[model samples]
Target: MNNNQNIAETAISCSGISKNYKKVEAVKDVSFEVSRGEIFGLIGPDGAGKTSLFRILTTLILADNGTATVNGFDVVKDYKKIRECVGYMPGRFSLYQDLTVEENLEFFATVFNTTIEENYELIKDIYVQIEPFKTRRAGKLSGGMKQKLALSCALIHKPTVLFLDEPTTGVDPVSRKEFWGMLKNLKKQGITILVSTPYMDEASLCDRIGLIQNGEFLKIDTPDNIISQFAENLWAAKSENMHTLLGDLRANEHIKSSFAFGDSIHITIAENYEVEKLIEELKQKGHKKISIKPIKPGIEDCFMELSQSA
Candidate 1:
């Protein structure tokens, strides 16, 4: 592929990117691209090295090997220029706790040599929510309010690319939904976004996602495509004795994997296995109130399968 194709067609491109801390490798030779005006998510559980990868792309840290470019600027050579063109909201809240909401916004704007009014339109929708308590200290703000304020500060610079590392991690369900809504509006303004979260349900909101685990990318594709690639037949089974059902399923030779999801146990059966046969086998094994049926695989299901295979 042409270098310019990555520059002109995508907002970020990384090739053979790897990072290590002492003997442990935080990120393996990873490579992926985020197209302009698209929301690309990094989906994985904790300790997946999502934060390490974000630090490299945002110029906070250098990779041990390989190269990456953000907005056509080299992460190492063009560090200064790249810093000016990208917005990063880290996984942890890093704003000044002593500073009020208004003060925090002003500080970030000043760092980029801009003013809040200059980019007010970019963050109007999000900022307005916390504007009522602009005089309150950031440390006193609610988790949801802090999230909104951090996002507003990141956007005050009018960056071409935004990197949000688990921005919704500790927030409530309603706040999480609202935060995603704000992201969609930002996408409409032609800003490319790369977001990471452990919540599997959020995977479908992005245009595409990369499933990472233990510093390795297992799969990268649209949510639908990833779910479609689930190889073995899957069944959702639940019995009166839920705990016993899990133990028995794990011991069964025909079952590939079984894990609890909500009230149902999602089971990936051995290839070519029939659901009816599995149910009969469970009943014979002294499982009562057993209900089993074929069900579609989800992003979490795919992640579980990939992690086990890896």
Candidate 2:
């Protein structure tokens, strides 16, 4: 088939992509594909090469090794076309700070050789949230409003593939939820979204996720699938003295791993170890109101396991 047919099958593809900053390797031979109109997330913390990969894919920077294609166009040779067809919102708010919200959106539309009237329906849901402040300067808007305005500017051009780098970092929890909702609606409109975020809770929001760390992807699969791969016997532990509980649990030979989760410590014990024995040991050590029980592993647990193994 032709390039258009190929483009219909995959929105983005990268093979052996690598980038380095002097002595540091930002990305290490990473490869992945995002299907058209799907929400594929790069789930990792800051400096895990999420931004580096995004820059390479968006053709803003060249990869030191390997190749990447966006909408079937080679990133290096077809950069101009890729730039025109893809929308990118970097980790920082990179819009014109001095310009009003309406002006910023109009400017992006003009740069893409399109008018707001042409693609207004595409960003109407998002723009309407910030339309009342259309005259306000972009820098003066609140965190949530700035996020919405940035999203509006990114979508003004009606790009085929949208790349968002840490879009919800500083926004309130409510805005973060609403931003993901907007993404779901955009997916319905046949726009492919590749978003990066450090929030583990947001992993479940995507169709699939790649667990990245230190510039490498430890695992890539649907959230459920990855969690299913966690075969260890996980348990949650809590005591009146939360601070001392972690050290005591790790000091025990039966405990294989222990990490503090919200309001408790999650641990994986030695195979065939009895939970009662561990509770008794804690009780002897003066840990009052001790609570220990089996628990299912989440994305964070899986990441810790994978990182340890790697």
Candidate 3:
């Protein structure tokens, strides 16, 4: 039998979860289950109900309807148990800025009625990296270091389920890489991790991801599976006049969708449209140094296709 299978099933579960603020629907009919020891990502841009859903799961707020559970403890009825067993690191820096690195960890440990010594092994890898700056106030640390401290505190209690919301939002490339590495290590200890991020590149790091936008889940699967299901003929088109080229492509009758992607524009064509003809149209429009090629779809491309279809 699989070790993961022998462990607890359904680390987190939500059914028809919904929340609203006046006329705005933050989350609608959301339902999903995260298996024990799995790293699940809620991938979406800001204001995409990631935070709203995180709040409901962490017991920081309530959902207007529906039910959710963390580690089989109801989020509403058993909010206290959920809090005790879960570690939540919100998107914003909620740690005490005035406190030194060591102080923040101690404070959270005490708040949870445990000493840092109790779970020192759980956070040793993360804490050792920031130990040299133990006396520095959290506000004085760099963005990357601050995140590390926040993570250290979150793990001090050795919670079974971890919820990290956009932990790498403003972090640097190297720190982002380091942070994901840390999450990988934590999973080895059989801790269930649910993380949210806006970076499409980070989506591939998760065991599974849920694509959320406009308060709804667009798709949920392994990153490879999502991209494999991108049923579109995507092309990368670029020219010296990228700005004008974007306008030209969007106005074309054969294009289903077109958007600027860094140095080039990614386009989805109406079914059965040939790429050669699209290149010819751009050339006829006086597009110089124009280049177009059929390309493999990444997660961003998949999200675009799904978002448009939805």
Residue pairs that clash (backbone atoms under 3 angstroms), model 1: none
lDDT of 1 by residue, 63-132 (tens): 9999999987889999998899899999999899999999999999999999999999999999999999
**For each candidate, how many residue pairs have backbone atoms clashing (under 3 Å)?**
0, 0, 0
What lDDT is obtained when candidate 2 is compared to the true structure?
0.92
List candidate 1 stretches off by more than 4 Å: 1-7
Inter-residue clash pairs, candidate 3: none
The models' CA-based lDDT, in order, is 0.92, 0.92, 0.92
TM-score of each: 0.95, 0.97, 0.94
Model 3 TM-score on a 0 to 1 scale: 0.94
Off by over 4 Å in 3: 1-7
lDDT comparing candidate 3 with the true structure:
0.92
**What is the RMSD, in Å, between candidate 3 and the native fold over all Cα?**
2.3
Candidate 3, residue 114: how far the Cα is off, in Å: 1.8
Q: Say which prediction, candidate 1 or candidate 3, comes out ahead on TM-score.
A: 1
RMSD values, in order shown: 2.9, 1.9, 2.3
Q: What is the C-alpha lDDT profile of model 3 across 173-289, one tens digit per residue?
A: 888999999999999999999999999989999999999999999999999999989887788999999989999998999998898888889988887787889888889999999
Poorest 10 consecutive residues by lDDT, candidate 1: 1-10
